[model samples]
Structure formats: C-alpha cells, structure tokens
Target: MRIIKWVVRLLVLLAVIFVGGAFLLPKETSVARTVTMNAAPEVIFPYIANLRANQSWSPWLDRDPDIQLAFNDVPEGVGAAMSWQSEHPQVGSGNMIIIEAQDPRRLVTALDFGEMGTATAYFNLVAAEGGTAVTWGFTSDNGNNPMFRWMGLMMDGWVGPDYEQGLNNLKKLVEGA
Candidate 1:
C-alpha cells in the first residue's frame, strides 16, 4: 500500500513537470535549409514560383510517388496552389498556396496541414559568389498549446532533412539544366 502511494505521487509529479516544461518552450518554431546552386535566381525562381514546376524537385513526392496532387489554374506566382493527398503518413494531405512573390528574389506560401495546423513556407534567393543561394524555410506558430509547444522542439530535426533533400534535388535539376 505504501509503495502504491509513492508510485502515484511520482506519476503526479512527472505530469506536473511535463506540463510546466512545455509552457517554457518557445511559442514558435522554424526550420530552414540553404543550398547554393550554380544558376541565376532567374533560373531557379521559376521552379519555386510554379507549383507544377516544383514537382521535379519536391522531396515529398519521392516519399510517396503515387501521391495525388492537384494544382490550381494559376500555376505560377501569387495565388498558385497545390494540394496533395497520400496514404503514407509522412506525405500526408496538405495544401500550399503562394501568398507572396517577389519575382526572382523571394516567394512565400501558406501551407495547411489540416488538423496538424498551418505554417508559412518561404524561399529566399540571394546572389552568391558562384551562383544563387536558395534558402527554403518553414515557420509555425505553436500558440499556447502545450502539446504543440512540446512538438515544436522537434520540428527542426523532423523537417530539416526533407528540406535538405529537396534543395539537393533542386540543385541537381537546375544546375544540370
């Protein structure tokens, strides 16, 4: 009976610690990956600005090759949108729409992952020494949700590799073109 009481107390203490720790976590999380491709921004911007063009380099497609993708009529620049559905959990259903486009410099998209919430994805192009530096990034507001706050801590590790692979695919596509 004494051991059972002690075990219950320990579990209660752990629950309190976890909840308190989650509140201390950041309210936002972001992940970004950059790659310098031996191509001008003008050359790379099209692939990013156009949802259809992105098909060649998007890593998620590789994860679920049979994933169904639907693109809006405006396939490039602002208002361009693409929604995808896949049975694969890693390539779950989501939609992304281009919200801002700065020609060959920057592009921003709003991404909706349904119950997983939404995030902002962006591409920034900068002229570098040998070519253009393309930075792909994602940012999510965890809000006041303790569960989301805890998950935010792992966002980078979860998303970074996919970004890296996507950038690498982009580099190969553009540089080889």
Candidate 2:
C-alpha cells in the first residue's frame, strides 16, 4: 500500500512538471528558406503578391485537401488578403493580409490565427547568379503565453522544411513558366 501511494505521488509530481514546462516555453520563433528562379522578379512577384497565386506552390495548401480559402482585395499585389478555415488541426484556421509590397522585390504580410496567434511573413527577391534568389521567411511572437511557450522550439523544425519545400516548388513553377 505504501509503494502504491508513493507511485501515485510521483506520477502527480511528473504531471505537474510537464505542465509547468509547457507553460514556461518561449513564444517566438522564425523559419526561412531561399531558392533561385530563372525568371525575373516581375515573374515571381505575382506569385508572392496574390494569395490565389499561392495555390500554385504553397506547401500547406496541399496538406488539407478540404480547407476552405477565400481571397479579397487585389488579386496579385499590395492590399491582397487571404483567409482560410479548416477543421484539421494541422491546417488550423487563419488570415493573412498584405501589409507591405515593393513591386518585384519585397513583399511582407501579417498573418493572424486567432487562438493560434499572429505572425509576420516576408518574401525577398534579389538578383543572384543567373537568376533571382527568393527567400521566404516567417516569424511570430507568442506574447509569453503559458501554453504556447514550447512553440518556438517546435516551430523552426516544423516550419523550416515546409518553407524549403515551398521555395523549391516556387522555383519549379516560375522556371517552367
């Protein structure tokens, strides 16, 4: 009886520790990927400007086949907005709006995920080698949410690969176009 009581106590302690750790994790993280396209910045800006254009190469779009997405404002430049709703946890639900644009060069957007949180995404196109080098980046601050502290650790690994894949896909599509 004493052994069982000790075991129960230990289990409770462990649970408390785990919960505490989750609540204490860092809330900010970033992921970035770069790729070069044979096409000019003009050719690539369209893809970055319009969320609708993102369907051609966005890594996440293919993840949830049934996700409902809506776009508004300009179809392919500053002022564009895209929002999505999905039942899948992997897809979650969010909206992103174009907050900055330097035609054929730099594009920046603000993304909000309600309970999931908010983030900033950037796309930069620079001349490199024989083509344009495009870099995609995302960053978010969790505002020290107790439950979201671990997100920063998981985010780099989680988002990095997807960013790389998205860049590669963009390269292929723009090169082919």
Candidate 3:
C-alpha cells in the first residue's frame, strides 16, 4: 500500500512537471530556409504567388503522388487558395490561402491543417549577389495547449528539412528554366 501511494505520487508529480514545463515554453514557433536562385524576384514571384505553379516544386507532392489538390478559380495573388488531401499521414489534409501578395517582394499565406491547427507561411524575395535570395518561412502560435507548446519545440527539426528540399527544388526549376 505504501509503495502504491509513492507510485501514485510520482505520477502526479510528473504530470505537473510536464504541464508546467509547457507553460514556460514559447507560445509561438517558426522555421525558415533560404536559397539563392539564378533568377530575378519577378521571375520567381509568379511561381510562388500562384498556387497551381507551386505544385511543380512542392516537397509534399513528392511524398504523396496521389494527393488530390483543388485550387481556386483565380489561382494567383491575394485570395487564391489551394486545398489538398492525401492518404499519407505526413501529407495530411490542409488548405492554404494567400492573404498578402506584394509582387517581386513578398507573399504571405494562411494555412489551415484541420485538426492540427493553423499557421502562417511566407516567401520573401530579395536581390542577391547572383540573383534572388528566396526565403520560405512558417510560423504557428501554440496557444495555451500544452501538447502544442511541447510540439513547438520540435517544429524546426520537423519542418526545416522540408523547407530546405523545397527551396532546392525551386532553385533547380527556376535556374533550369
């Protein structure tokens, strides 16, 4: 009976620690990757501003070959959106809508990952030594959810590689064109 009481106490303590630790974590997290492409921002802006054009270099598409994508009638610039569904768990259902589009400079989108929550993604294009330096970034607010706060700690590790690959793919596509 005494041992069982100690075990219960230990479990309670662990639960408190886990929840408390989450409160101390940052309420938001972000991940970004940049790559220089041998093209001007104007040449790269269209590809990112248009949802349909993104399909050509999206890293997630390669993960789920059969993923279904639906795009809005006006598929470029602000208000354009795309929703995707996939059987692959990693490539789960999500919708992204362009909220801000500044030609040849920046594009911002709001992404809804259904139950997984929502995030903001942006692409910034700036002139570089050779061409345009493109930066792709994602940011999410973990809010007050303990689980999400904890998950925020791993967001960079989880999303960084995808951003890198996507940028590499974009570089190849733009440079090769």
- CA lDDT of every candidate: 0.95, 0.87, 0.94
For model 3, how big is the CA root-mean-square deviation? 0.9
Ten contiguous residues minimizing lDDT sum, candidate 2 = 142-151
TM-score for each of the candidates: 0.96, 0.84, 0.98
Rank by lDDT (best first): 1, 3, 2
lDDT of 1: 0.95
Which residue runs does candidate 2 get wrong by more than 4 Å? Answer: 1-27
Superposed on all Cα atoms, the candidates' RMSDs to the truth, in angstroms, are 1.1, 2.5, 0.9
Model 3, position 111, has a per-residue lDDT of 98
Candidate 2 lDDT tens digits, 2-104: 9999999999998888778876666567888888889999999888887888999998888899999998857866789999998877678999999999998
TM-score of 3: 0.98
Give me the displacement of residue 14 in model 1, in angstroms. 1.3
Model 1: residues >4 Å from true position, as ranges? none
Q: Better model by TM-score, 1 or 3?
A: 3
Q: Put down candidate 3 lDDT per residue, 51-145, tens digits, no spaces.
A: 99998899899998899999988869999999999999879999999999999899999999988999999999999999999999999999999
